[model samples]
Target: MTAIELRNVSRWYGNVVAVNDVTMTIGPGVTGLLGPNGAGKSTILHMIAGFLQPSRGELVVGSRPSWQNPAIYRRLGLVPERDSVYAFLTGEQFVLATAKLHELADPGAAALRAIAMTDMADAAGRRVATYSKGMRQRIKVAAALVHDPEIILLDEPFNGMDPRQRIHMMELLGKLGAEGRVILFSSHVLEEVERLSGTIQVMVAGRLAASGDFRAIRRLMTSRPHVFLIRSSDDRRLAAALIGRPEVAAVELGPAGLQVRTSDFGAFCAQIAVLARDSGIRLRELLPTDESLESVFGYLIAN
Candidate 1:
C-alpha cells in the first residue's frame, strides 16, 4: 500500500527551523494536515513532494526516499496551493499537457476523464486567465489527477472554492479515500478538516502536536478541564449545586451565564440535567464551549 513516513525529519534555512524533528506515518485514506499558517504545513508538503529536502533524518513515500526520485511521480499527484497553471493555455490544453507529460497510454482520453471528474468540462475550452479562482483551482486539480495517481497531496485545496464547489471536492476526496487512495490535504480551516478527515495530524510551531482521531486526542488531555457555559432560571442555585459535584472542578457565575470547568466530561454531562431538575432550576441553555477543534488546537498550542 502507498504510505508516507517521516522519521525525525527536520528542515531549516540557516538559523530558522521550518519542520522540527517531526515524525509520523500517513497511510491509506484521507489524512488532514491541520495547522495555522506558518506552522510548517506547506514546508512539510514540499518536502514530501520532493521539491525541498529535509535537513536531517528520513522522509519516505511508499517505503522509498522521495528526494531525487522522479519515478515516484507515477504514483503521486499534487495540487499545490499556489496558481501554477499557465494563463495562456486553456483548461483542456493544460490537463492534456499534464497527461502527455505523465506519458499515459492515451493522453487525450485521460485529460477528458480528469476534466470531467473535476466538473470543469464546461469551462475546459476557456483560457485559464479568464477563469475565476474556484475555476482555476478545479483546472489545477484536473491536471494533477490526469495520471490517475494512487496518492494525492493537496495544499489548501478548498481555497477560493464556493460552497457548492467545496461540497463537490469534499465528496470527491471522500470517495477517493474510500477507494484506498492515500490522500493528504493541508489546511488551517478547522471545520474543513473536521468535516472531511477521520484522521488528522495537527502541527504547531513546526512540531507534531497530536495525531490519529482528534476526539481521541481531546479525551486524552486529562489535565485540561472541559469548559461549558450554562444558563438557567436560577443561576445561583445551579452554580451552588454544580460546585458540590465530584465531576466539576470549578464553577463561576458570570454576567452572561455560569462558566463550568469539569475534569470528567461524560460524568458532568450525565449529572448536569439531574442536578438542575433537583435544584428547581429550569435549564435555559447549555453549551460545551470548548468541545470544538478550535479549542483542541488552542490547548495544544498553549501547552
Candidate 2:
C-alpha cells in the first residue's frame, strides 16, 4: 500500500517555482531523496509532512489529504534538517512530553521505549544542551518514534553523526523498512544513499530530475565517462601504457597527477590494477573526482 502520494503537485515562491508538476508515491520501504543544495527536496518534504501546503494539486496520506490535517500526524513522523528541538529539556523529559502531546495512554513507558530504541537510555537524563550533535540527533529520533508512527521522513539525518553513528542509524532504518514502514530520507551524498536506499528520487534545481530503482539509476549515472585522478610512481609509463586501451578515452598529466577519462568503469578499474601489476609500478592514489551527488545532479540537469 502507498503510505504517501503526491499528484501533480506544484509549489512556487513569488514566481520562482520550487516544485514543478511533481508526482510520486512512497510505499512501505526505504527511499532516498538524492539532490544537491536548493533542489526543493526540503519543500517537498515539508509539503508531505503537512507543514507546507502545495499551491496546486493534491498531497495525500493513505488516500486522505495531508494538508493542515493534524490527524495524519498520528501515522507520520518527521525529522527536519534543522536541529531546533527543546534544547533545555533532558532527553527523557523531551520524549515523554512529546508522547504526552500525542495523548499516549502511558507516556512514560512510551518515552522509555523510544529512548531505548535509540540507545540513548544512558544519557536520557542529561540536558540536550550538554549533549553532542550526534546525541541530539538520537534524541530527536527518539522523539519522532515516541508516537510509534508508521511513516518516517528524515532530512539529512546523517548530518552530525560520525561513521559509527551513521552505520547504526542505517541499520535501525533498515530494520524499520523490514517491518514494512515507510522510510524516506533526504541526502546530498550519493554513496551513503546508494548503500542504504532501495530506491532513489533525484531532484535538481527545483525539479524532479530522475526517479527509479538505485541500480537502474546508477547505470544511468555511470553511462558517462568515469573520471579518475591517478597518482602513481611512474605516471609517464602508466599513462603511456593505458592510452591506447579501448576503455581509456583520454589521459592527461596535469598539476595534481594523471587525469583519466574512461567510458567503461569496470574495465577501467580492472585495467588499472592489471597495469600496475604488469608494469611493476605502484599506484599511489586513485580518486573519482566527479562521482559526487552534486556533480551527478548537475550532470542530470544538464542532460
Candidate 3:
C-alpha cells in the first residue's frame, strides 16, 4: 500500500519557495529521503508529518487527506528533527502520556514496552532532560513506536549517534520494517542512506531528483563523468597519451596528479591499467574522485 503521497506539493514561506512542485510516494519498507542541507527535505517531511500545510498541492496519507486530520495520528507517528520534548517528564512518563493521549487500553504496559524496545528501560525513571543525545533520540523513537503507528517518519534520525548507537537504531528500524510497516526517514549522509534504504527518493533544490533502488541509482551516478587521479613514472607522457585516447573526455593537471574525466568509466579504468602495464609506466596511485551527496545534488540542479 502507498503510505504517503504528495501531489505537486508546493510550500512557500512569504516569497521563498521551500518545496517546489514536489510529488512523490513513499510505500512500505525503509525509504530514504535524501537531499543537501536546505534542499526542502525537512519541508517535505514536515508536510507529510502534518506539521506544515502544503501551499498548493494535496498531501495524502493512505486514502485520507493528512492536513488537519487528527485521525491519522492514530496510524502515523512522527519523530521530528528537533530535540525538544517534554524534558521535565521521565522517559516512561513521556511515553505513557502519549499512549494515554492515544487512548490505549493500558498506558503503563505500552510505556514499558516502548522503553524496552528502545533499550531505555534502565533509564526509564530518569527525566528526559538528563538523558544523553543518543538516549533522547532513542526515547523519541520509542514514543513514535509506542502506538505501533503504521507509518513512521524520521528526520535525520542518525545525526548525532555514534557507530554503535547508529547500528542499534538501524537494527530497530529494520525490525519495524520487517513487520510490514512503512518507515520513511530523511538523511544527507550517502553511505547511511545507501546502507539502510532499499529504495531512495532523491531531492535536489526543492525538486524530486530521482527515486529507485540503490544499485540502479549507484549505476546512474557512477556511470557519468568520472575523474581518476592517476600517478605514474612519467606523468607528462602519461597525460599526453591518456588525453589522446578516445575513452578520455577531458584532462587537467593538478598538484597531486592528473585528473582525467572519462565518459566510459569502466573502459577508461581498464585501458589505464593495461596502458600502465604495457608502456612500463610505474603506477603509483589511482583513486576515483569523491562523489559526495553535495556533488550529486549539484548534478541534479545543473540539469
Candidate 4:
C-alpha cells in the first residue's frame, strides 16, 4: 500500500520548533489531521508534499524519502488552503491548463472528467472571477483530480463552503476514499473532522497529542469528570434528588438550573430521565457541557 510515514520527524527554525519529534503513518482511506491554528498541520502537509524538508529524522512516501523526490508529485495531488486559481480563466480552462501541465495524453477528456466529478460541469464555462467561493473550491479540487493521483491532500477544503456545498464536497471525498485512495485533509473544525474520517491524528502545540478513533480516546479520559447543565421545572428538588445518587459526584443549584458533575457518565445518562419523571419535574433541557469537539480537544491538551 502507498503510505506516508514520519519516523521521529522534527522540523525547526533556529530556536523555534515548528514540528516536534513525532511519528505516524498515513495510508488508504480518509484521515483527518486535526489541530488548532499554528499546530504544525500545515507544516506537516508541506513536508509530506515535499515542499519542505524535515529538520531531522525521516519522511517517506511509498518506499522513498519524500524530501527531494520530484517523482512523488506524480502520485500526489495537493489542494492548498490558499487561493491560487487564475481568476481570468473559465473553470474548464483552468482544469484543462492543469491537465496540460501534468502532460496528460487527453487534457480535454481528463479536465471534463474531473470537472464532472466535482459537480462543476455546469459552471465550467464561467470565469473563475465570477464564481462563488464554493465554486472556486470545487474547481480547485477538479484541477487536483485531473491527473488521477493516488494520494490527495486537502488543507481546510471546507473553509468557505456553505452547508449544501460542504455536504457535496464531503460526499465526493467519501467516494474517493472508498475507492481505496489515500485521502488526507487538515482542518481545525472538530465536527467536520469527526464526521468525515474514521481515523484522526490530533496535533497540539507542535506535538502529536492523540491518534485513533476519537470515541476511544474520549473513553480513555476517565480522570476528568463529565459535566452536564440541566434545566427542570424544579431545580432545587432535582438537585436534591441527584446529589444522593452515587453516579453524580456533585450538583450545584443555580438560577439557570443545576450544574452537575458526574463520576459515571453512562450511569448518569441512563438514570437522568427516569429520575426526572419520578420526581414529577419536567426536564426542560439536558446538555452535556463538555461534549463539543473543542472542549474534548481542550481536555486532551490540558492533560
Best model number under TM-score: 1
Candidate achieving higher lDDT, 1 or 4: 1
| lDDT-better candidate, 2 vs 3 | 2
Stretches of candidate 4 off by over 4 Å are 228-248, 251-260, 264-289
Candidate 3: residue 285 Cα off by (Å): 14
Provide the lowest-lDDT 10-residue window in model 1. Answer: 289-298
Candidate 2, residues 1-303, lDDT tens digits: the string is: 888898899999989899898888889989998777888999999999998889998989988988978999899889888886788999899999999999999999999998998889999999999998898888888899999999999998888898888888888888998899999999866778877775878877777778867545544666678789999998988899989789999999976889999987779877899888899999999998776654665677777
lDDT of 2 at 72: 90
Taking all chains together, each candidate's TM-score versus the true structure is: 0.88, 0.77, 0.78, 0.82
**What value of lDDT does candidate 3 attain over all alpha carbons?**
0.84
Query: After superposing candidate 3, which stretches have Cα over 4 Å from the reference?
Result: 221-223, 226-298, 301-303
Residue range with the least summed lDDT across 10 consecutive positions in model 4? 212-221
Give candidate 3's TM-score. Answer: 0.78
- In model 1, the clashing pairs are none
Over 1-303, each residue of candidate 4 has an lDDT whose tens digit, in order, gives 858899999999789898999899988999999887888999999999999999998999999998899898888999999888999999999999999999999999999999999999899999999999888889999999999998999999998899998899999998899999999999877887778875889888889999877766765688888899999999999999999899999999888889999977889999999999999999999999876666767888787
What C-alpha lDDT values do all the predictions have? Answer: 0.92, 0.86, 0.84, 0.90
Going through the candidates in order, what is the number of backbone clashes in each? 0, 0, 0, 0
Best candidate per lDDT, number? 1
- The parts of candidate 1 lying over 4 Å away from their true place are 230-241, 252-259, 269-286
Tell me the spans in candidate 2 whose CA falls farther than 4 Å from its real position.
Answer: 220-298
